[model samples]
Target chain A: MRNLHTDEIIKNIKEMCIEANYKLASDVEERVRGAYDQEATALGKQILGQLAENLDIASEDSIPICQDTGMAIIFIKLGQDVHIEGMDLEDAVNEGIRQGYEEGYLRKSVVGDPLIRINTKDNTPGIIHYEIVAGDRVEITVAPKGFGSENMSRVYMLKPSDGVEGVKRAVLETVKLAGPNACPPIVVGVGIGGSFEKCAVLSKKALTRSMDTSSPIEHIRELEDELLLEINQLGIGPGGFGGKVTALGVNIETYPTHIAGLPVAINICCHVNRHVSRVL
Target chain B: MDQYINTPLTMDKVKGLQAGDYVYITGTIYTARDAAHQRMYQAMEEGKEIPFDLKDSILYYLGPTPAREGQVIGSAGPTTSSRMDKYTPLLLDNGLKGMIGKGKRSKEVVESMVKNKAVYFAAVGGAGALLSKKIKASKVIAYDDLGTEAIRELYVEDFPVIVVIDSKGNNLYEIVLQSS
Candidate 1:
């Protein structure tokens, strides 16, 4: 069995949080630049230029890309053959979030209660998902999810006969409803075929995928391309003023489900879709 | 067309503006978001004094991140405006001449803008790092316990925005939707 120290996990998580907030991932930056070149409207081009400039400033000045540093969403792939020493895994992750938000000067957006909201102060208790995997190495991915777009996400439990067309309608409707509110040119993550909750989780996971990459499954990849084209055609544009680039990319993830149900979830992420990953 | 505007915007100045005009605003404005708005609306309901004077004032719906060492403010950008729709008409009626935010406002809020001769501006949301450069100074004026959600008085220089809704109830978002 491979033994891993808890401090290592905490240290990595802390670094991931700070770096993810301070710098836009290169793939995302590239996609934004590409969108800027392709955008037709004058206002859309100007907005995309400012977005590119913002990314540069954040990297150069070591400042956050957006005021809402977002609630930390951590995805962990734990090795079956590895054992953690000195702390509970979940506690270690939360400690990392607390330290990251405090030291990085990132915003503490978390509240203690849903109804009578009170600041959590240090942005603790990150949303963590775990999976047991085959190797001796652990892979950790951190995605800071801002609520502006998170609030726009939706799920539909479709009839077995509804099929692909239903999924398309649902995604378009969600994007249309989001309009300028969720920050266009957005990144759309669609999850299909799982149970309700599982589909939601899958949609979020799909968002962590790189914009430059496509789904390995050929049919699903085609669907992603088609959705991207239709969404951009909506002319939501950058900042939703009006243009040809409404979405930077459309990512779809799927799972096999019971024959009776066809579940789909859409998790919309803003242009500043910040995520970073590390393997140890 | 792009224009330069000064804060404490008057009805005359608001009337001169129209939907789709890009503007750079200078001078003082206040910041308030969900928690602060709720508190202010509650205070107004009870006939209590608000944290700042309302006449001819502009409010920006933002909750900026805390400043790091030497900076005047952290990434400051507009939050979604529709969330503030519930309390907006009250403020507009009380001589809040302008608001800075993004997204569509409620129909009632737009009507209130028309009735009160107010205006609504949209700052590019998620462009906080770029926007913060315009804020020359900032300090919390109320609800310090609310942290980022506190009401802040800010002195900004050439802060960029687009006129999304005008005094006549003309809406830029609707115009864009129709054209698209």
Candidate 2:
């Protein structure tokens, strides 16, 4: 059995928050750099070029790539054999977020209550997802998701007969509807074949999956490639100024579902899809 | 084409801009987002004098991150503008000459822009780090308690934007849709 202190978790989470905001994961960054050559439209190329410059500036000067540093979303894979010591797990995680936002100069985007709409002052109370894995290590992933694309995410409760074609149609329609609003040159995360809520979570997880990698499941891998091709053909382009590079990548995650339903969700993320992971 | 101009735009300047025209704006503009828009709209509704001058002014839909030590401002950039659509028409009617933000505006907002001879500008979304360099100065002018949503008076130099909707109501978004 492995013993871990909450202090260590707090320290790592704090650094992860700042790191995720400052830099795009390497797999994603490589695609963004290559996108300038792939983009067909002159204006689209220009937009992509600016995005590359923004990425450089963000890293070099220690500034966040986007003003909306986003609501903190953390996913942790806790080892069943490991014991944690210190504060409650949730508070330690939030304390990390609070320090990261304050010290890193990231935006405090959260409001304590939806209706009252007062700023939380410090960006805290992050959404954390925990999974118990068979190991002695605790893995944490920090993804600060911006709301522009978050607000555009959608889920469909498909009838069993809707099938793969229906899934494709739904994704296309959502991308078309999003147009420039989702901040094109997006990372499209698709979740298929799960319960409604499960699919939504899977979709968000899909964004964290490495862009250089594809699903191990053969059919899901094919779907990812096909959807990516179709989305880029969308003419949404970079900055939605019209071009052939509307999406940097399309990632799909699937799970078993009831025979009666084939639920699907699309969690759209802009080019600034910030996520960082660490193991302790 | 890139045209350089100052804010507190006049009718002639507004008319000169067309959909798809790129611009670099230098001078003063007021920043406000959802909350401040609501408050200003309510103030105008209540027949109270709004804090900033509306005539020929540009309302930038931005909620910037707080500046770090020795920095002018933290990652400043435009936010989604449609959320402010409900409060936009009244400001345009009173004398708002331009609005700077990203995404499509509502039909009513566009129509009001046409009626008031105003323009809508789109900045590249998520390009905050680069955009912040263009903002030379910033200070909260009103609603300081609203935090990031507070109204800020900003002095910008050669800040880039594209005219998405012109004074005559030609919208670049629709044009892109139709052409494709």
TM-score of each: 0.99, 0.99
Candidate 2 to native Cα RMSD, angstroms: 0.9
Candidate 1 per-residue lDDT over residues A1-280, each given as its tens digit: 9999999999999999999998888888899878888999999999999998888888787678999899999999999999999899999999999888888999999999889899999998799999999989999999999988998899999988988998999999999999989988899999998799999999999999999899999999999999999999997888888899999999999999989999999999998988999999
DockQ list for all candidates: 0.84, 0.80
Model 1 has an lDDT value of 0.92
Residue A43, model 1: lDDT of: 95
lDDT of 1 at A74: 100
lDDT per residue, candidate 1, B1-180, as tens digits?
A: 999998879777888899999999999999999999999999999999999999999999999988988999998888888999999999988989999998888889988998999999999988899999999999999999999999999999999999989999888877877899
lDDT of 2 by residue, A180-248 (tens): 888888999999987989999999999999998999999889999999999987777787778888999
Model 1 vs truth, CA RMSD: 0.8
Candidate 1 segments exceeding 4 Å error: none
List where candidate 2 sits over 4 angstroms from the true fold.
none
Chain A TM-score compared with the true chain A, each model in order = 0.99, 0.99
Candidates in order have lDDT scores of 0.92, 0.91
lDDT of 2 at B160: 90
